[model samples]
Target: MAKSFQNFSILTSIVTLSVLMFSQGMLDTAHAEEYDFVAGIHNEVTFHFRNGIETVNFPVFSTTSDIVSNIGSSFEVEGVVGNNPYLHKALDEAYLYRMSTLSGGNSFEYNYRYFDVDVNIVQNENVLKSFKYDNCEISGYSVSTLTDDYESYLASDTGFAIVNNIQFRCGGVGINLDSDKSSLNSESRSFTDYGPLPFKLAEDVRTFLTFEFDHGSEKIESVIFTLTSGFSEANDAGPSFQIITAVLPHPLIDNAIDKSQKVSGMASTFNEDFDVSVEFTNSQETLRGLDFQDCIVSGYDILTLRDKEEGYTGKRGFATAEILDVTCSGLAPVNPAFDKLSDAKESRSSQMSNTYTTNSYNMGTGPHVIATFDFDSGTEVVDFPEFYQGNMIARANPTFTLVGVPGSTPLLYHVVDNTQGSGPKSTGVSSNVELFDVNLVLAYGNDVVRGFDYTKCRVVDYIVRTEHDADESFYKGFALTDEFYFECQGYEPFNPKYDELFETSHAKTESSSSWKEKQRDAWGPGFR
Candidate 1:
């Protein structure tokens, strides 16, 4: 963007006249008969900061260009029309108005031409209402022209009037609608006078009170006007001071594929109220058919893009929401393996000497084997061991003793020469053992296919063993086995059907324990 001080000559002329009038005591006093409050047609807007001031104005003959001041707010003025360049500048220019004070002290090199100014509404040569707009910026700017209209343009009113048409994002608006002259806030308040003056304009005051707010289709409640006018400080009526306000556009969601998911009532800033899930729901609509029923909002990003395109005059800046992922959901599948499994599988293949290919897949293979066993002990567990099947059994005692061989050669034996039996063996009655519920689950891969519930089982003894034999039919010679000797507390032991343990108390106990362990492992050891 180029800076054009094209109005320097005009400003010098105005200052020269101002100094002359001051010397003649014409600018010293308020409420004087010679004082004039009418505004000039060729007006200039000046931005006064703590360090210095920068001023801008339209060409003397240009009528197509205009300045819009939102009192207690900002100024959006079209820049000088030219083929050279435009003020489609950076967001830093417009965002400077975000400050509490209207002045941004020389921090930027390019003046996007935004500032606060006071406006005096004058009627019948008398001031009626006063308004003030604070920190401001050129919110928008555009340049456009068509060839067919050149004939009409040549016949029209002016030339070089198509340049600096820029909108503004401004800060607070303060107004003094004081009709009574009893207070200092009367319309006659000091204003920084600019341009050649009959001291005023012949146009109706309402004609100068135009402001286009960026809110979507909402009704406007107030009218703020900004200008380079105020009571003269030399007149003992120093430039009138008024409060200002920032009017930001309503937050919007654009370019969304799913319009139904775009919800309203999201806050634009942290100061506003917001719901995390609601925002997430709306943000997810940026892409179609993308829904996360079990997702959470980890953080948010707000992008404020400045409007720099021609023929686009709605909002000066737009805010877009960006989503971030966070693992805050506490839902787990029915089986632990299910959490570790993926929908797709990875595989590799190998070819043997016979040209038979073997493909190994990453997916879990289904359970292919089930084993059954039976055992008996004398004490209520079972009737007896399988005596008829040639199984070796160890009795309570044996008289003959044998010693092992040394270096795989020979064995030694000690023979009992005498035996004594005093009397008949005494028999004792067996007592019943208490039974508690137990559940046994059968699974294939990550899926639980069946479960068994023993409602009245007192486990006497259980053994788990792996045996190996060279003559086994299977590829691997090793076999895993589990044996359980359980006694029923009731009169008769009935086998419960499979899948009957789905809602059993024992199942629930195990599930709860597993859940607790999973939570601790996921978060921390302190988690319960």
Candidate 2:
């Protein structure tokens, strides 16, 4: 954007006189009061502009052209009409009169001239872009013809007008609205001075105007503006101070999309009570949908944009990275560098691969894997495992030894019910009761576990006990029994030593001398 902002300086040569000061050669023409430049134009619609202590009047003779240049930069001033440059020059003959301060110190610069059917004004920090009177049916009036048809312009006057696009900047931190986009605010000064605004000096005031936001910042906790007009340090009877404050409701979070800060109350300075919320998302899909090239790095307000995506106005998002760690007692080889989990057919892959690609999965059985996550910043690497739901590979068909303790309940398989064991038809007793610990070393289906959370579905051991019993013969009162060595088909005896026998009662004669020798046969040397 070009530098379009500059203050207009007034020329020192223009002077207002109480008595007529015209040339003696022209003294015979007409009224000397016409030469008073500060006198407002009354023929058409009365109008006057202020520059601190001075007020500018409409030209009386319609012959001068240097007045507007003395006041400010030239932009086809409203009082003068037509695209033709010279026809407009004739309207400059009007003069301006110096007026007293109707209010505060000369703190504001006010200037105006008809420009494109509207008045253009420079009011202090704000620029009055346009001010138009629609109710006044005046037309066909030019600088050269205004004096002649000044009465014609006023003849069709109504009582309404509108001021459009008064542009101004409120720059700096704590100076911007929440979820905001623009630094420029547009205010309107309408037909309040009994005319189309700024008709005279005393009526100029910026009241109850919202001071909700400042410029150059979005994370402002709160902003406040005090509108104190009548009470400048020089005037006690000036305006009372009215305060307006806007506070942010919540702190801005990282990668959260469509966020906004609500006004603390119902009234605020914003055109709308709430601004466009911070348009951002942490979702990768959402980011890709937008001009993804402009994704913001990590934690920033919604207004922050990437250099490459300067023109992108859509919401933003963040990137993601994660890792899984597996610590197993019976694993093949620790390969943190292995990419495909399929490689860990009998071992774990080094490179963090998808857990789904592992050889086979197991829950609480041998070799379980754990996983760790690196969310937005991807700065974390894991040592031990935690959140993974698969199995590991080790010895497959594990061997179990058979040894029966004299008293302790054994992990029985194919346990025969009392009623079934008592029948004469029963051959060998081995049927219902059971307890088997299903421990196995399995491998991964993949390196990484899929889905939102770890889908841990592994086949471990289920020790079957009497958690539910509807019959008494199921676990009680066995009749006929014999010594039976129960063991898995291909397994060897564990040869576990025992200290005592369970329910065998002996006579005093056998207990007296050779009790140790007789019992030694059943439990060997453990009878003592």
Candidate 3:
């Protein structure tokens, strides 16, 4: 069997304004506004080799040239148009232009120009070799124009790809001879010259092959896998079997497939004895799911959980010490004065008298006269006595005198009931009769004469009289005719007594005799 030969290669290059800094006579441009760069593979190809024959699976030289042109135009338009204005300005000012190309065989180059200055970047190739069975190969590559554009290109196309070839050669196929004196020419009868022949030798085998470039072109910024080979049965069964799972960090394979049979329900089942089950409780401690035990009640007081006394079910929980009944003494007795007046006791005589009277008398006929007199009744002299008693006898139309009568004299008097017909009543006059019933003698002599007609009396001695009586008598002698008359005499002197006395006695009197002297001592004068 013929050997299978598969080759793959990848390349990448990145350029930036920093590269222009190293060029001679390439002064950094400060404010160039716009710039352009190109990034595309110049030639990329993939071939399948069988028996030393190569068939182009993906040919970039002729068929894929449009793809390269489109890529280059895309980079020039997108990278330049979207770049920072200052960076574009610097590039344009420096006349900076860059180009990058990548081929299928991990071949790449970066060419930069700033005016007359030029720079080249390259990445060396990474190759894999095998000699056991037919060799199979695959490769990936990429190329970047500007540093910024490189990132964009990788993000878009990721990386490059190279096709693989499958081929076989029969073992033990040596020189052969034909019959009938015809000889088979070894050179003339090539491998294809005869019909299909089969031969076998070693065990079935497989391997991975890749070609990568590291041409020292601004370093290999990153290597990414854009394509990968398919999986095989051997990969599923191998101890370290790997399948292409992810791409960014080169490639990845998970152990899930390699260890699938070791899972539950499979022949090489996973260990069920090692499995554990857990349960969560409302307590601080944990217990195994299969175990049962009483939990320790944290933060619970045992004393609070038990009754205070045995069989004491009054309160289910705890209680403090019982408080004995308390009694207090030493309170002072309240005064009866402060107590509310009861209905029975409240009827007692009032402490403050309500009726008020003055000593002055009225002279006008129909006017009221409050006559006041002092009396010597053999006990103490009553200054302003509350009651007076007397019996009065009529001496019709009698006249009396008022002068020089001492106020101490007593006389018999009566309150005549003027409301009756013509004469005194049989029941006699009561002491409580009105004062007008007693005809007050304006003045009186020594005569004991009395009656409502005392308006006539004149006597040898002056006299004044008021009514008085004994406790049981209907009428009694009150004071001497002297006392009442004396009061009357005093009042008659000042007929309009109230006003005249008040002015004379209450006025601010002056010691001076003459009218001039009195006027001189008036309020505004020097005497003031």
Candidate whose lDDT is highest: 1
Against the true structure, candidate 3 reaches a TM-score of 0.10
Give the count of colliding residue pairs in each prediction: 34, 52, 54
Candidate 1 per-residue lDDT over residues 1-528, each given as its tens digit: 123464776788899987655433243331212211112112233344333343333211111111111122333443334222122233344455435324654364345454465433333445433435576655455555312245334643222223445555556544333342232233332222111111111111110101111221111111111111111111221111111111212111111101111222234422111111110001112100101122222222111112232111211112111222122222111111111221111222221111111112232453311111111110111111111111113341111111111111000000000000111113321233233443333444335465333344333322222232211111122222222334333222223344455645543355777887777778954654
User: Sorted by TM-score, highest first, which candidate order results?
Assistant: 1, 2, 3
Q: What is the TM-score of each predicted model, taking all chains together?
A: 0.21, 0.13, 0.10
Estimate every model's Cα lDDT from 0 to 1: 0.26, 0.20, 0.19
Model 1, C-alpha of 238: deviation from truth (Å): 44
Question: Residue 493 lDDT in model 2?
Answer: 18
RMSD of each: 36.3, 35.6, 58.8
How does candidate 1 fare on TM-score? 0.21
lDDT of 1 at 351: 16
Which portions of model 1 show Cα errors greater than 4 Å? 1-44, 54-75, 79-115, 120-128, 143-148, 153-160, 178-528
Q: Which candidate is the best by TM-score?
A: 1
